[model samples]
Target: MKQLLLVFTILFSPSFSAQKTETFKIKKYQIAILGDSLKESSGLNFFNGKLYTFNDSGNSAELFQISLDSAKIQKKLNTKLRNEDWESLTNDGENFYIGDFGNNLGSRKDLKIYKIPFRDSLVLDSTKTISFYYPEQKDFTPKNLNNDFDGEAMIFLNGKIHIFTKEWKSKETTHYIINPENFENQAAEKIETFKTDFVVTDASYFEDKLYLIGYTKLAKVYLIVFKKSENDTFFRETPKKYYLGSAFSLSQIEGIAVNKDGIYISGEEFHSPLGIKKGQFFFIPFSDFD
Candidate 1:
């Protein structure tokens, strides 16, 4: 595991100026502390009415079925794939897509997404890889966390995988698209851009509302919701940004999955020279924040 990189992100992350957003205390919504198995849980999503999650790079290429009531792992399903740097999770109804494109260093040349057909709660034998690269990223230098090519959020819609980048320097997110059907290494088409002022780690599109979750360099976590996207572009409308306390208080908020009942969020365990915080699972109802 990138322990040095983890420490670097926690201690050396650059700060950003604040923007006006509704503040909400998130400790009350935290239900459980995710244990060691999911201490590095990076993303969350609902597939076939079941919630699922997995750790990031250097972990097993397995998905854990999370129980909503207990926030515990109900089962683990192996995908038999290489978990180079799994960062995003989403489903296209019948298949689950995992984005193995965590380019925090902005030095990766081969970014890919795994597509596995899932049915009856089991993965089919046929698994495919959707390779992609950023055409705009001409330089292959290691910028650590200062680059804009790092992506940890994606949503599958309209026969496309839309990626939202975790812009470390600009404090913004750029929208890019990749076709899953293309077996060749395709260039992710940059479609839109939004100055979120916070790093977007995971995105969930529920109903007409698109939810983005991530934190800042100074550990301030945020949740932004864009509603009623008419042209498939979520940035078209004004989004409701909510301040969910600091990462020290609410863990390292990294994952979000929205449903009719409420919003499901998970944060990976964070540790540094300052202090250590355990990973946690949170459930916030729409009425509480909406």
Candidate 2:
């Protein structure tokens, strides 16, 4: 009888010990205040030692650069391009890409991305805009367009643009690559598709790795890491989730960007009795994520 009890204890104890060995890594992030009451903080990008972001729905759709150390708006430049539905922002070494192709209802036939030159010394008083369209699909009025595709996150790589769709009621995402040089009424080619258990909001590529961010219905935020595969594909590695605590009491979170310094995220809004409050941005040190 004692021997039987000892055997059972060993069996159960090993299982418990294995479970104890498995742990989720939780990283801490610091919330940095950009603006108090921003109407719609859509796209965020950190480039050339400055952080840039823009408001979606606003009269003066200007791109503002903030100092990384002080977190203060260093320069606010009015963009020549209009912000009809700007969703995501990314930058290569030479130019900044803004995704004006937001199709929430999946009914936007005229989706486009604007490429503006990255000027360091000169204040961007005026900018040139170039547009590109998806070649495969034309009419936005698909029977199941909601489940098809939409644009939210973009990354510029190797003289081409890579766009990722935001899965609004689904757990899958589609990726497309476009050569802006072939924007003469040509369509962007579909590259690959990836599915995740979580709903992705934004993504950024840095140091040969892709980082994806998602917001749960409970207002929780999760970070997913993927390494580039052999054929220039992205494969999911280990995923870590973090609770961003709370931002202004509202839950809908969006916008993510990465630089050599750290990872940055912005929340949409929180529900309040008085009214809806503007979103805020947070930064996580790159070392913490590493």
Candidate 3:
């Protein structure tokens, strides 16, 4: 009887693992090698047909514009504002928003987004500040990067700024919204909550589609695409998720931008018990997924 049970376990274990495992292949191409200043490039966006990115915590408040042909920094936009953990970037045709709310520990009270009026050039002096807080969070204690209130990805949608939280404790994402016109320190409206099981690093919206990029605790990278749903709400429809790759090959992916050409991704240099990698820039053609 014991031998029979062991044989059953051996025969069924592989099937069980296969049943639980879901993965999608992505065709990736190397774009460039990011510089030291952008070793922690945590946010990415495309403005005026140019790709831009910036470093996250412990870095300067500067935005680097990269040339697609050469895949090198062509210009750097300097801001007088402090970079207190800027984590995401978004734009609304005429203006740009920089999210300064990387509360990994969930103890932050000064969460804000800087809005810069833009047309022909990037302006830093004429920027406005939009502040917000979660209405559901009552605790101000630091939890050491394992909290639900932590957020690093956001995008502009339907006249409002939608923020996606990088949940560490629950592995779920909470959707929130803030009015761009209202800059007062008000409570963000909770839209909905869903299980992502990965930390969202950056988000982008284009052509009525939502694109999000993130990584797992084990360094597995993923991309989630949400098509337009009823009334234009992202949660009303099921999302299509695709596995990008592993950190051993891609490092700590932290940024994503999708356009007519393809999907662009960047990662910060990573050094862990598993492996070490440098800051990288990569692209995956839409044909591979579409």
Identify the candidate with maximal lDDT: 1
Query: Please, what is the TM-score per model?
Result: 0.94, 0.77, 0.89
Clashes of 3: 0
lDDT of 3 by residue, 253-272 (tens): 88888788888888888765
Q: By how many angstroms RMSD does model 1 differ from the true structure?
A: 1.9
Please identify model 2 stretches exceeding 4 Å from their true place: 1-28, 36-39, 121-130, 135-139, 142-145, 236-251, 272-277
Q: How accurate is candidate 2 locally (lDDT)?
A: 0.60
The candidates, ranked best first by TM-score, are: 1, 3, 2
TM-score of 3: 0.89
In order, the Cα lDDT scores of the candidates are 0.87, 0.60, 0.78
182 in model 1: Cα distance from truth in Å?
A: 0.9
Q: For residues 59-132, write the lDDT of model 2, one tens digit per residue.
A: 35577786655346778776666777777788876777777876656676667777677777323553445556
> What is the C-alpha lDDT profile of model 1 across 1-290, one tens digit per residue?
13322656667766676656888778899889999999999999998789999999999999999998767999999888899999999999989999999988989998999999988555656889899999988888999878989999999988999999998778899999899999999999998899888888999998877889998777788999887465588888778888988877778887999888999999888765667788899998888866
